[model samples]
Target chain A: MAATIEDLAQAVFDGDSRKAKKLSQKLLDAGEAPLDIINQGLMGGMSEVGVQFKAGTMFVPDVMAAAEAMSAGVELVKPLIAHEDIQSLGTVYMCTVKADLHDIGKNLVIMMLEGAGFNVINGGVDVAPEKIVEDVKELHPDIIGMSALLTTTMLHMKDTIELLKEEGLRDQVKVIIGGAPVSQDFADEIAADGYSPDAVSAADLAKSLVGAA
Target chain B: MYRTRSLYTTAGFQVQQHLFWQMLTDDQCEAIVSTAEELLERTGVEVLSEAAVKVFEEAGCLVDGSRVRIPSTKIQWALRNAPSRVTLCDRKGNRAMMLENNEAHWGAGYTPTEYYDQEKEEKRPFTLADVEEFGKLAQMLPNIDFATQGGFPTDVDEAMAEVYAFKTLVKTTTKPIVQHVRGLAQAQPIYDMAVAVKGCAKELAFDPFVALHVSIEEPLQLSADALEVITFAAEKRLPVIVSNELVSGFTAPAESAGVMIVALANSFAALVLSQLVSEGTPFITGGFFTNNDTVNELHPVGSPEVSLLGGGFANILRYLRIPSYGFGGATDSKISDAQLGLESALSTLCAGVAGTNVIAGAGVFESGLASNPNLLVLVDEMACETERIMRGVEMDEDRLARGVIEYVQPAGNYLATKHTRYYFRSEQFWPTLMNRKRIDDWAAEGSLTLGQRTMNKTKSLLVAYSPKALKDDVVAELDKIAG
Candidate 1:
């Protein structure tokens, strides 16, 4: 046999992203369908990772590595996928809001979302609401995730939502808010669709919002 | 029949009282001060406040915009004028603490935002109640000599939190407080409160109850607020602790010596400011120093480098004959774990040996951002260990006990002897909360962890705590001043 899908799955499961990319290219050269390599080989390994993570046999970093490997394999097949199917689950626009330069939590959510095979556009730290609204209009993401470490900057998240509503883009995507100072009540009062305490749960919330979970 | 004697009774063993261990050589200490002096002359300091710049200018120092270049003689004059020994009194005007020699005083760190509740195993913004409880705990704890405004209370007005915390501390404990204030504006109310407690401003000035701490901006700078407080402290005749923050490879040079020079220079600048304000203001000099984790790029507060730098700084300050303020009994670990134990022990040991005066950073965790009462209880145990280590071996004929050794030489032990009883209580260090149970006994009693045992001990301490009440008249005066 020239190569098997099992080899690709093994590379991804081992979190060997470089090897994953190489093996994925080999499978494609062997005339394997790109979708077959993704769903069966990459996602298959990731599914196992999710199971192991829930079972407590695998940790967050391990899952992250597996997700990274899956992402590497998926990058090889990305050009071949149909435009509508580019983001397998959904796309998210993430940013730590203006006047809050803190990014530890925001970056965590971005990593978690990307690991779950979502296209994450990390709108960088100290991001203004206008810039986010402009990006939201251009990207038309499936979910908008806002984070702020400071209580003052958290208000800007509400302002961003208001701008989204004014621009008539509120109905198109779900709004998810989180951070150290952010509470569920704050989210509810601001008309956010969902809220999560931490990154992993935020990824799950993003999945559920897009009807993928 | 011979009676069985256990060295460790209910809790654990203790180290006998000893002298603080020294880590650096005399030549090394002299080099550090020289380096600090050179840096001060070459780099100068950015004094942000116009008033402070004016003061520096009037003191015959060269002022270029905000930067003030003070010659070595100016610093020497300030050092000579500044009181080397500061006596901090309790509210009753009793001289409770003398900050001199190589004596180390373990106290709490100031303004931690989060308080870790052991019962719930959760961290939340500390309320005024937590501040009050911390005061009570500090008052009751044997190892903690003084208290700080432990945390910012969420319930109180954000601007007034420091004064409120001070009010709570003054009421809850009679221990001398190292008050953390915002600016000269806030210092007035705190000064008034101290004056009320000590019967008058003149009496408060003569026997200072609260010592103010002001931090300088890193890389040779002082904020307007800091200068204001320094001036007020100088005028009020209260002791002031000038601290600086220097993270290796970030705010300061990656070299350990460079970081020390930066910190000490900042303290020297503050000393100059204080002397110009008033020639004989009592001052302590030291600051925060920790190496940046080269790989993670994070400031690990409990790094071994922190211990080395802290210990080195203490030695240098001792050589300078100024009271030293440095970190001790704190950890970078977020939770109670082996890492916490190791880091806290190492830092406390280094601080104890190095002779850091007014050693703070006890109970602080998560790299100085959070604090817990239980963690404080554990850190107290570590302080006791440091105290014992610092005490070292008390070498004398009585300690040797040649006659007693001969008497118990062959078969009999020293149990039930008058010499043993007389020396047993003083010779051995007894831990109040440390677990020393047999394996079976420990497992049988539910296999509690050190954290659990500490929580239990902390709870009892809080329950058993009875505040040494401030008189109603004093309370009324305090409330009026705070308002």
Candidate 2:
């Protein structure tokens, strides 16, 4: 007669977004603790998704679907918890660097980070160094992430970091970079705080950077 | 992978039916043909050559100034008249290659103006000797089945370049040659030269050793040079390849299907003209589908779009029962490196699996401006690998080898079995350029990279190999023609 939190977990695992959101609202309104509904219901299903993904039983689109469903349920549960009580991995400001219009990889990284409980501000594509610096100053993110698919535009990642230094904001923010042409050596040469080869690893590196892993 | 059952017969050869792939279904292919026919009827192609425009006008096509808008019935008639299979012969005039369905054949590549000179370690203009060397390389490479103009020799006059290249290629290689000449001036002499080698015009025409390639300018402009070449090819009963590079973001529509519509219309127009000139003339059709990259603003032959466009074109051409031409083993990298290997491998593999006939570009690279014999050797190895992949596994009872498996059950090895001995060569891909040795053993043998090994092999072949020389009379005849 009553829909339990186990049904909510099953909804998230099955990627049923509407059912998961409805069940989440139903449970929270029924006086279930907000964090309990998250850790045991939403994250409970997402953790199984992560395990199956690493076990090769699931694929990228599958993980993305599960992530979307979890996010849908989380959207209903969040804001009910106190501001400081909710644990976020970190805040990341992300954009594709100047003169490059590619954003497929950047969008995937954002989805992955958001799925992993990180607060991400999407800066979109073709962002110049000056504009990126202004966004960083205003957003006050814990980490800044940059993406570029072209070799010419990847150099702008360095320029953005240099401009951040010139603006005296480099010391306060950790910078990470990813793209087809951006390598780990390139990250080190440009003094990037981190380099993730793919969207899945970007989440792990973000969690570790914020000391949340 | 070998089968004995025959599905169709043409040109005295029985073609086996294999499970070849197509990028489009039957309905999609028919839709493309319909759209292309409509394009021809509505917005016609510009026939800059007055002679070609007159032919189109006399055939009841709408002629507005230089533009010729053709009817769908004329195109359908041309499709029926054009031979589905165009058989090519070797230097001796024995049928060798049957270009039907997805019978893929590898050849030496797109004409290059410059070449990598290993001795000087620099890229420079090609000499006449370089053209001869390319012919020799094509003849020597086991997997390379035919020859195309590999380089434009700068030492020769621009007017005489095609003639001289043909003379060298005819003398050095026994394989079928494809000529993309400037006009009838070069094409005529080359045909006469082939007649001289083959002994008579009638015999040469019947079992043609060469095919004429005509380039239709992008956005549908057929120049006098292209028309003259195609006309000559049709009258002589020689096969002709009507092709163009429909580069997306430049000469063609951005979407693949939109580009396909243009490609089909352009080549179909040429086919119509050829059929009108002489019914039952053999025609091969395709578009070198590629993209003009945003970074370089050049149609990079190695890009993935080349494979995509080539595969789709091949599928549609096969649906129409026409042979197709495509590209493979070309690269965008300026030098031989990991990028070169990756691009060449993927493109060649795609061409192989898609069942494209006459896949060219063995050595040409740097967006098709340079040729490297050493790189060609590396590509030849990749071609071998691709061929092995094309020879898919046999699933019949003998190949199932249940008996051998049961005998060698539970962590047993089949290395010394008779089944392994009998099937290893056909099943495994043997590479010539790839080094597969232990690190210490490799270092002991001088730590040769693939490039170094390719150079050694190329130089050794050039030094030790030469095609059997032409008869003294034929040589004098060729000299007179070249003069």
Candidate 3:
């Protein structure tokens, strides 16, 4: 019997973590591969939710519930997926800059990044520039994401990027910045790789930059 | 009843009078009035509502599509009907007349910008409990005269959330509330809640005792949702505090004068629309103007020019015979540190002296990203002092020389005089935290920064405070909705 995508998609859409795990497991047992389940089930369901979210047809809670469901499905199939397949996508390191402890934007990026199947290292908030550079050096992350909600702290993003350039590591990794005060022009002026207004778009930019999409 | 006192020091009064003198000469003021007339005649503000446009057209305004050219006569007519003094209502059926003509009133405000948390991957829906708690905190604090049900409660259903929050706030505190509603569906509910709290019926609620916070993105292009809210609130005869935020480069020309003109045009447009909706709805016209720094392209409120613009706008609002709203305690700095304090104090003092009716932006941080309850406690102290400064000292001939010299000659010290005993408390604001202990006592307690002290104060308030319990029936209804 051909397993319809709707059953697997419904499990993710319903935010039923238990059913999502079971459905993905059943799909794999029925001979569908793990990558197929991720591409057609988890990613597909999340994409639909993102559209609804942007259109205001659904709100933040709806998106959160849907993300939870997709995360559940991803958890079930993660062990079955090969390391080589997972490693195909590049890594992204994200953090809110120092002296700014707020983290709603950073968390949204993490959710979107994980849903998009990228390896994400969350450095959390008020992250010092030295720590970010150290993480960059050790992790050799392909992309570094920085966020600053305050206009005063946003200057720290510029300082971190300057430090990276001085260390001869600017060319090694792509840097993307976003927050309330950050704009596309500001990102361009700061000479960063990109800027996204919101989290889902940030995921799209991250994937495109790394040639994962 | 508390008697209002002048809150001005000589230094503060001189500083504002000088700025006002520099910004507007008689000729310059006349020029601005002429420019406003030109704008009305030539460009005319767009009236999105068909009925509002027709009202203007019938009053001899030129209509080109949605834009209605408000002739000088129409502007004069609208201003003539606008009340110079309005009684804003409190929760307990008491009222305060915010004199709108020449005199300014001072009141403390709470900033409402922190509800969006893009970083935490979580948006907390601020509940009715949060609103009630905030109101209780405001009530206990000596700083605030008015309370805005704490900014953006996350738990609220956005469609009609503010109505519930305002209802909760009115029940919890006696302070006059700054009622704000954002969407169309919320208008009727907010009106109903206000009437119920004010103990009035749908027919007689036109008491001009309740204050409604009305905002517009542009003068002519009001938010469709906000307009509905204003209309519903105005029908109850509430005084509309029509305010606008003019981003120098983006919203208006980069020139300060241009920005002021545009803000004035926008404010007047709102005033006209409000009047058209309900003829005698009292109005407060004002704008929040801060230039975008060309170097940073970020709007910082601390610059001297920004202060000048705010002062000028306050003067303009007074000239138009309406009360005004001013930004108080706002700073570009992210952290709740020295930068926040200096910027907040300077900007707030400028607006307070310029005779603003309601001053906001207190206790906010991260350029309005975060609202720390501790910062609020500190800012309230500043507001208390600022209000003392706004009430200018009486200097009439009899009070100035007679008792002062006679008492001083006899006693050699005014300490024993009745005037000193009567006016000491009125002369200065007693701070809650600033002078808590002597130097040696403070040293024994370990020198704590204001931030630390504020944190302690916030925690104490949060722990000790109990909000007024919602009605059992309303609580059950809300619980069912929450589920």
Docking quality of model 2: it rates as: incorrect
Off by over 4 Å in 1: A1-213, B1-18, B410-412
Q: Which is superior by lDDT, 1 or 3?
A: 1
After superposition, which runs of candidate 2 have C-alpha atoms over 4 Å from their true positions?
Answer: A1-213, B1-19, B118-120
lDDT scores in order: 0.81, 0.83, 0.69
lDDT of each residue in A1-213, candidate 2, tens digit only: 577889888887776778889999999988999988888888788777777866656555565666677888888888788888877788999899998887767877786787677889999989999998999889899999899999989999999989999999999999999988888878999899999876777878888988888
Evaluated on CA atoms against the true complex, candidate 3 attains a DockQ of 0.00
Q: Between prediction 1 and prediction 2, which has the larger TM-score?
A: 2
lDDT of 3 by residue, B177-208 (tens): 77665554655665555554444664225443
**Chain B structural similarity (TM-score) per candidate:** 0.93, 0.94, 0.82
Displacement of the residue B304 alpha carbon in candidate 2, Å: 0.5
Residue lDDT tens for model 2, B57-118: 99999999999999999999999889999998988878878898678888767478998775
Q: How big is the positional error of residue B119 in model 2, measured in Å on the Cα after superposition? A: 5.3
Q: Put down candidate 3 lDDT per residue, A71-169, tens digits, no spaces.
A: 878888888888878754778999999999877678777778888878899999899888899889999999999999999999888888999998899
Give the distance in Å from residue B394's predicted Cα in candidate 1 to where it truly belongs: 1.3
DockQ of each: 0.00, 0.01, 0.00
Candidate 2: deviation at residue B50, Å? 2.1
